[model samples]
Target: MAIQPDSAPSELAVAEALKALGPPGLLTGCRRIRGGDEQFLLPAERDSMATRDRKARAASGAGRRIVHELLRRLRCEDVAVLRGPLGSPMWPPGIVGSIAHDEELAVAAVAMRSPSVRSVGVDVEPMLPLPPDLRAVVITSHDRLGNLDQGIGGRLLFAAKEAVYKASFPLDGRMLEFDDISVDLKSGEAATSSGRRLLVRCTARPRILALAYTP
Candidate 1:
């Protein structure tokens, strides 16, 4: 069943859920884009024991509604959203988009008329320390030894790479590794091995965040 905006969880619960996801810095400046006139109703109740399930469900539903509204605003009819073979969300015949959700937060980015916009992906992880081994999986040898310098910055780098991979998958139709992209921690930007630019920017302090729309 779809989730409904009317069922939105409390702000406190949403905040707590985002915190549990880690990387609080990512939440900085995250804004919700409304779907304007195209909002739709989603089922409010679902089976779940998680403390933040309701909040997360509500946020995801709101995100989906906003995407539909945005498409409508852009005069994009013929909208069809489906799951790709790899389970990535797919959009209508002439539209392209990406949707992401973590705990109580959900975000979506849609582009009209052409696949020329290529890839657009967003991810948000709470601000918290990560296990060394998992951290290693996210940062490349060069990044660990170079600009990233192995710390909180390294974690953000990892998150940025994850977002990049999410944004790029639809364009290339393949899975990508952290090493497949070069990220400049100082610059907050990522580029494909082939020099395709992927811009990543963070907002807020002690950040609760959103990373989106990689080129």
Candidate 2:
């Protein structure tokens, strides 16, 4: 079942999109983009809030709350997620997950507790083109998968890279530039030029949602 936020009609659409992309064990949460309203942080999480600007505070708090809610459902409790040096959410021992939001939406995915799954990542972005200069900076020769659908190329690549970054960081820990990964739209996979691959499932309608997972 989808975890729906209060009074947000668009969340229904977001939930449907999530269902299409999220695998069986993925836990999801959705809310209208807002700031400073989440109230579920534990003491340590509260202390870490000192550094975030309002927008960051709200989004991170909401994302963590979603993660905690999922954890509680699995009978895990009292664990507080913190941000690591690379800015990814730090899950409790033996847990792995990802979080993402834009100015209008917030969603998170947590892998149900298990030993085999290595990492999980989920990102949400509006279906809009990157600005021209940003487009130049984010697109690279490797990402130009020939004959990929041109209409959604820019937006698709950007979302794919983000999902790849979130999915890979738990293990790689290196900050990756957009060029560090190349995406093959035809195969629905993103790969490092050196060949590390993450399976990417993207929903391009209504919005863009990408979920990446590694074994």
Clashes of 2: 0
TM-score of each: 0.63, 0.88
| Residue range 106-208, candidate 1, lDDT tens digits | 5555665332355556665555544588766766655532443355565666667777777677666667777887666556667776556766654323443
> Compared with the true structure, what per-residue lDDT tens digits does model 2 show for residues 67-111?
777778666787888776657788877777888988878787876
Q: Note the Cα lDDT for every prediction shown.
A: 0.52, 0.74
* lDDT of prediction 2: 0.74
Which of the numbered candidates is closest to the native, going by highest TM-score?
2
